[model samples]
Target: MVKKWLCAVLVSWWCLCLWAAGAEHAGEKPLNWHENAFFGLHFDLHPNAGDTELGRETTAEHIREMLEKVKPDFVQYDCKGHPGYTGYPTKVGAPSPGIINDALKIWREVTREMGIPLSIHYSGVWDSRVLEEHPEWARMDPHGNRHPNYVSLLSPYPTERMIPQLLEVVREYDIDGMWIDGDCWAALPDWSPACQAEFTRRTGIAEIPKKAGDPHWEEWLAFHRTLFKEYVARYVAAVKAEKPSCLVTSNWSFTVRMPEAMDVPLDYISGDYDPSFGAERAMVEGRFIASRRVPWDLMTWSFLKTGDQPWTFKNAAHLSQEVSTVMAQGGAVFIYDTPQRSGRLNSWHMDVLAEVARFCRERQPWCHRTETVPQIAVLHSESTWYTRNDPLFNFGGANQPMEGALFALLESGWSVDLLNETALAERAGQYPVIVIPEVTRLPEAFRQAMAEYVEGGGRLLISGGEAAEMFGELAGITFA
Candidate 1:
């Protein structure tokens, strides 16, 4: 009897070890330059109004069908401000009445079954209907207009209310990550009571700056950046406390300095989705930023063809070009879909996605493995855009100079392209030398890529106003 029991125990232990090994083999690491991509739907799932079957469960099943069909690596199921409207049945707090669909639960099941990580898209300073119910939680301007539906980081109450709910959903649904939005809506130094008090404490200044360009505006902006960094740090701590491995990221302003702020504890950072309006140089700078971290997540919009806007269909090719370039640089590419009012995929948009997915799959392995080799790389600085936006600068219409600069590179006899850090991993070796012009920020991934490039007998030329500030010491160059 003893010998039989010993043999059974040995068999059980062996099986357990085999199972653990299998799980590890199946699990994929966070994205790097060569293997990063995400198929995301920002407003993918909405609750059914009537006679409709587009609730969370149905949507999850639908998504699962597509995932099964496509078998892509990543998917971002965003909720925007409608978190409470459609998701697992919440007894504690509900966003709106008569809503019944657990979007998180459905995504959790589907992604987990398919071995994919699910990311929740949360708004940083915007709530759809929470402001109406809780007036104290609302963000107020100098005139006390209540700002309707917008909320700012100035108030800690919203974080107190919303972060817990977010944590609850993640714990219950076993989610893998979060994407924070609304961080760039307003400039920092808001006059909210909490913000004012904190500003006074930090700067020892009793009075608030009134105009947009006060002498203290730079200080005020720094305060806002500090405030967000602290809040993000706290939020990241909270997320890790529960899941221990969940990713936390913010949709940073188009240009953000990633390496300088490494102490700010975010798993990763992403830029906005509208590449059409943004500079391709910014896109290339973004690639440099993504190369700083393990999994570089970059957001790009899909074909947003509505009834009136038919030209958007052609833009799909542009999106494909940009997204494919980013993926090749080793960043996980997220393709966004702006849903129709009916909450179903538009037929034309669907066709575009089908082609995009098909093309990506054909070269999927290459995208995940290639590195960037470029002749010129441009820098993207939010401060430059902010300055350009100021009417006093005489830079013409806001965002015009920056817009013009983006197009001029390609037309000015350069093989212009935008590459993210992840993209750099797969193709960085291809270029013997590169140029970074007009950018003011350096992300860690780009920093590492440059270091490796230069160490391997590559020459880099960094020019422009902000470029000197970001890479002065690193590149051994001085712009006089």
Candidate 2:
């Protein structure tokens, strides 16, 4: 009787799969690439540096030399703020005098010649000029103090002003991609007039929470995420409209809760840094590599104390794990060096990267694909992750407090990606089991989808925060 029941269940599942696939419309977008990839070495443009300045042709040439030497599959060009910007020979925004001669073309020509795709990095969070030029665009903290290096998503400038300049640069230069840094949309302050107005409009409540977990919080929090998602959609659209093949993603480290919304418009997604620093960081990084629908890139050296300043972590295990994780994910690994800040590339760092490069080359077939038979799908939602923004409810870490827990799983042999809820809705059936480590504030749409999947037989594990309440609310069921 049990065998008969099992067979019947299998048949039902097979039928559902067929139906879902057939349900797609002719104009519906196709599935995206799930592969391991590369992000280029990141060296910030310094005005006064050793034979290199921001926007200088020499810098691009030097970068090209490094790429030729490293033979990386992709590379990123840093566009420093103010006079140091490296985007292109732009008329909208003034690029550094360093490239006023012909450096921009050299950098562009070198990457194209090398056949390695180029990604440009920009600090979108804090622009001194933006603040100075447009005080209205600045986000004000509770104390009424404006923080440096932070941009208010509530400001319309990104879509109106910033994107056009970015497009002009891309179109003029024919660049292949973008990496947006300092995207603290989730952490944008509460005093923005735009946010206040939106909050009032959405929940009929004018008061914003002073902290993360205040009573009327989830609604406001949801708005913040919604705004960010829309911003991402717009940014991605601008790039793809100009160059459909161009890849683009913002830094999403701890901001995403459910699976990423792949349908939202992104060629790929990435994070600021990876924190796996021990022997086990490698496998966990590998798991992160495979967890995303698109290729993942690991940030290296950004978080470290530079050797030039002061070195931390004797072994360089952190750097090694960066490459390992990206390789494991069948994604790309990016190494960032901020002049004298991210320390000089020591022999140890170079050696680890070299080994990783060689390993990726050797395992090209397996390392270039997203994981199949994923043992776990970590439920990620921007709404839930913001719950940690509470000073009191402090879950853990700046990026993914659940990393330690996820690491435990990886150490015990598990792979995972911190995906947004939208991503979860579409791909829920792919995984047999999913673990929502402390997710709260579930989106109704994602909840309904998850409920159906689980009822049809999906195993779920959740911990910390309001995962229980959310599950109960969403599915009309609860799990401990």
Candidate 3:
């Protein structure tokens, strides 16, 4: 009887030690700003031909008025947009036409005084100036002609001109950070002499494929992926070297377009949710970003503009609904707004933001840093998306399958997490079930991890024909 009692006491003591250690570890984890409910504003201002001195002054006044009405944690103002035009006087890039004063400087001064963090919206990898000045820096097409739209990261423009200009904003203006736009949207496979030589050097293939399905097409795709990854990493490193506290993120860096970009040392992850499909996209992307365990936010358009139509402010009720959906999935909220050419913000927009801010602020207690109780996890393979048509592996194109799975699970009222392979390998055991939806190919390491997860009594639900054919035996079934 004494021996059994002593053993019980030892077991209880051991469990208590583990529990104490876990509590200490949890306490040591630092809190991120994104872990809380953050309300921010994104303003994209591109002056047109008619913008005059009166417009600039009025706009500046309205900016102060708007801030007073709707206080935000952060505001992202335009520095340089897609047209490679700066709203401020810039030595490194072209200034927008008809800009009489430095709008960025005014915004910096105002936001700083207001005690709000300021970020700039700068377009990267797609500068129209390079198209005109150095067309060779543009991405090359199969016809050996430069694309009129995008600049290649392989060019010296990003390192020499772009990074320098970005650092200039941080140093000269004392800005908080940069929300880099047009990175994923502008990245394209290049067939330039440099790319061709590098491909040959890496793969030992002298001839490069001209189009999809040609010889070595897969190798070409893989090469571009690696190129962009390295390109982003280098730029991020450069920015940190200059200003370690300067938050830098390429738009859509960690979303469906370039999940591998998470490997880059970015301060945070964010994407502008499509206005048309804002709710659905936010639900999926929020889970994806949250799984990375980094700070993330989703930007939604304040107005719903369709196909060259004039912009109109979204109703407060609609905006509130959209914000709630994102916050519920553990994402902060940023609303995108385009100011009038006169530089004045609409009072209606301010009222709308005020209402939405109130909604978010009220829910801070329950919503901020609240852990998501995940019931299901859907595996999203970045490799499958990147190498979709290689003929070497079976995988579907784009994120349609993953989206379909999310929709179905949500419709059935199940809480789901959209996990990348890395997240799944690490935390697959936490959830009750793992779902592989339409992912035809998975890396060997991920495959082994999934097998072990299932063998250890975890449940799995796999859909899609190709996935069934591959993982059928592991799930205790055969296709015959």
TM-score for all models, in order of appearance: 0.70, 0.71, 0.88
Q: Identify the runs in model 1 with alpha carbons over 4 angstroms from their true place.
A: 1-61, 80-86, 186-188, 253-262, 275-285, 291-294, 305-319, 338-352, 377-480
Worst 10 residues of 1 by lDDT: 28-37
* Candidates ranked, most accurate by lDDT first: 3, 2, 1
Find the candidate with the highest lDDT and give its number. Answer: 3
Q: Can you write out model 3's per-residue Cα lDDT over 210-251, one digit (the tens) per residue?
A: 988799887888888778778878877787666555677888
Ranking by TM-score: 3, 2, 1
User: What C-alpha lDDT, on a 0 to 100 scale, does residue 350 get in candidate 2?
Assistant: 46
Specify the highest-TM-score model's number. 3
**Candidate 1 whole-model C-alpha lDDT, 0 to 1:** 0.56
User: Which structure is stronger by lDDT: 1 or 3?
Assistant: 3
Candidate 2 per-residue lDDT, tens place, 1-480, comes to 434533554464345334434533343442222232443566555322223333423455454445544566566765544322433455765454444344445666776655555677766655655555567777777667665545677786687657877797687777667777655433454567777887788789966776655767666666765666677678878876676555677765322332333445556666654332422444444454344545565565534454466555323444554566556666666666443322123444444555555555675666656455666777656555555554212234533655756766767776565455666678788888877776657777877887798888998776764677767654456565
Measured on C-alpha atoms, candidate 3 has an lDDT of 0.76
Off by over 4 Å in 2: 1-39, 46-64, 81-90, 94-102, 185-187, 212-215, 253-263, 274-289, 306-318, 338-356, 372-384, 390-401, 413-480
Give me the runs in candidate 3 sitting further than 4 Å from their true place.
1-37, 47-55, 58-61, 307-310, 389-397
lDDT of 1 by residue, 165-227 (tens): 668867787666777776544333457888778888999987777667676766665676676
Better of 1 and 2 by TM-score: 2
